[model samples]
Target: MIGSLGLKLARFAVVLSVFALWEVLSRTGMVNPRLLPSASDTIAMLGQLLQRASVRSDLAVTASEVAVAFVLAVPCGALIGFAIAENRYFAEVAKPLLFFAFSIPKSIFLPMFILVFGVGFSQKVGFAFFSTIFIVIMSTTVAVDSVKTEYLTVARSYGATTAQTAFRVYLPSMLPVLLETVRISMIFNLTGVLLAEMYASRDGIGHQIATWGENFQMEQLLAGVLMIAIIAMTFNELVRWVETRCSHWRT
Candidate 1:
C-alpha cells in the first residue's frame, strides 16, 4: 500500500511540475502568453467558459454522442467477439483481419462519415461507435479466451446446458476483464466523437475548440483542452474503480 501510494504521489508531482513550468514560461515571457497562457489563466478561462450556456451546450452534445456510441458498441462488440472466440476455426481466420483493421487509423474514414451523415449528430455518434467497437471486440475476445478450460469441463460434467455454462462459467470468469474493457471503450468512443466533431460538425466541444484555435484564442483553446483532459481522467478513474471492485475476487 505504501509503495502504491508513493507511486501515485510521484505521478502527481510530475504533473504539478509540468504545470509550474508552463506557468513560469508564460509569466516570464519565455513563452508568449498570447500563444501559451499560464495554467492558472487557462483554468480561469475554463471557469468563464463553463458559465456560458453555449459552451455548456457544446459539452452536452459531445457527452451525449459519446454515451450513445458506447451504448451501441459494447454489447454488439461483445457478442461478435464471443461468437468468434467460441469457434476455433473462425477465430483463426478472423483474428488477423480484425487486428489489421484495428491498426489502420480510423480518422481516414471521417470524410466518408461526413459525406454519408452530413456533419450532424448522427455522424458523430456513428463514427464514435465505429471507432470504439473494434477495440471492444478485441478486448472481449481476449476476455473470453481468458476463461479456464477446467471451468467449462466441470460445467459439462455437471450436465449444464450450453446457456447454463455460458452464464455460470463464462460470464463470471469474463466479468472482470470485460469491466476493464469498459475503460478502453470509453476512451476510444470519446476520441472518436471529438475527432468527428473537430473534423466536420458545428455544435460540439471539439468544434468549439477548433473554432477557438482558428480564431487564435489561445486561452480558450487551452481551457477547452484542459476541460477534456479533466473529464477523460474522471471517467477513466471511475471505470478503474469499478474494475478494481469487480475484480477483487482475483486478489
Candidate 2:
C-alpha cells in the first residue's frame, strides 16, 4: 500500500514539475511567450473555451466518433482474430498481411475514407474504426493463441463440446489479455478520429485545434492540446483500473 501510494505521489510530482517548468519558461522569457504560453494562461483559455457552446459541441462530436468506432472495432476485430487463430492455414496466410497493414501509417487512408464518406461524422468514425481494428485483431489473436493446449486436452478428455470448451477454457484464459487490448485500441481509435477531424473536417475538437494553430492562436492551441492530454490520461487510467481488476482471471 505504501509503495503504491509513493508511486502515485511520484507521478503527481512529475506532472506538477512539468507544469511548473512550462510556467517558469514562458513567464521568465526563457522561451517566447507567444510560442509557449504560460501554464496559467493555457488553463484559463481552456476554461473559457469549455464555456462556449461551439467548443462544447465539437468536443461532443469527437467523443461520439470515438465511442462509435470503439464499439464497432472491438467485436469485429475479436471475431476475425479468433477465426484466424483457430485455422492454421488462415493464420499463416493472414497474419503477415495483417501485420503489414498495421505497420502502414493509417493517415494515408484518410483521403480514401473522405472520398467515400465525405467530411462528416461517418468519415471520422470509419477512419477511427479502420485504424483501431488492426491492433485489436492482433492482440486478440495473441490472446487466443496463449491459451494452454493442456486445458483444451483436459476439456476434450472430459467430453466437453466445442462450445463448452470455448466458454469454460478459452474465455477465462483470454479475458485479461483482451481487457488490455481494449485499453490499447481506445488510444488508436481516439488518434484516428482526431487525425481525421484535423485533416479534413470543419467541426470537431481536432479541427478547432488545427484552426487555432493555423491562425497563430498560441494560447488556444496549447489549451486544446492540454485538454486532449487530460482526456486521454483520464480514460487510460480508468481502463487501467478495469484491467487491474480483471487481471486476477489470468492463470
Candidate 3:
C-alpha cells in the first residue's frame, strides 16, 4: 500500500512538472499563448466554470449516457460470454467475429445510429455500448473458458448441479478477470462519449469544448478537458474500490 501510494504521488509530481513546463513555455512566448493557454489561465477558467451548476449538469448528462450503456452491456455481454464459453465449437467461429466487430471503427456507424435514434441519448448510448461491450464479452469468455478441469471435477464429485458449480466456481473465479475488462470498457465508453458529444450532442462536455474551441476560447476548452480528467479519475478510483472489495472475499 505504501509503495502504491508513493507511485501515485510520483505520477502526480510528474504531471505537475509537465504543466509547469507548459506554463513557462507559454509565458516566455516560446509559443503563442493564444494557441496554448497557460495552466493558470486554464485553472481560472475551470474555477469559474465550476461556480456554475449548469456545467455540472452537462457532466451529469454525459455520465448518465455512460451509466446507461454500461448497464445495457454488462448482462448481455456476460450472457454472450457464457454461451461462447460453454461451447468450443462456437468460440472457434465467434472469436474472430468478435475481434472483427471490435476492430470496426465505430465512427463509421454514427450516421446510421443518428438516423435511427435521431441524434438523441439513445444513439449516444448505442455508440458507447458498441465501443465497450465487445471487450467485456471477449474477456469474460476467455476467463470462463480457462477454468480448470480439476475444479469442475471436484464440483461434480461433490454432486453439485450445473447451476451450483457455475455460481460457486466459475462466476466467482471469473470476477477478478472481468473487473479488468470492466475497467477497459469504462475507458472505451469515455472515449465514445467524447466523440458522440463532439459530433452529435448539444449538451455535453465535448460539445462545450467544440463550441469554445471554435470561438478561440482556449481557457474554456482547457476547463472542459480538466473536468473530463477529474471525472475519469473519480470513476476509475470507484472501480478500483469495487474491485478491491469484491476480491476481499478471497481473503
Best by TM-score: 1
Stretches off by above 4 angstroms in model 3 are: 1-9, 244-251
Please give the RMSD to the true structure for each candidate, in Å.
1.5, 1.7, 2.4
Clashing pairs in 1: none
Q: Native-vs-model 2 lDDT?
A: 0.95
Instruction: State in Å the error of residue 99, model 2.
Output: 1.3
TM-score each candidate. 0.95, 0.94, 0.90
Off by over 4 Å in 2: 249-251
In every candidate, how many clashes are there? 0, 0, 0
Of candidates 3 and 1, the better by lDDT:
1
lDDT values for all models: 0.94, 0.95, 0.85
Q: Per-residue lDDT for 1-251 in model 3, tens only?
A: 57998999999999999999989988999989998899899888899998888787887888889899989887788789879878889889999999999788877787887888887788889988887788888988888976788999999999999889989988778787778778878888888877888888878777778888889998899878888898888888888888898888656
Estimate candidate 1's alpha-carbon lDDT, on a 0 to 1 scale: 0.94
Best by lDDT: 2
As a TM-score, model 3 comes out at: 0.90
Name the candidate, 2 or 3, with the larger TM-score value: 2
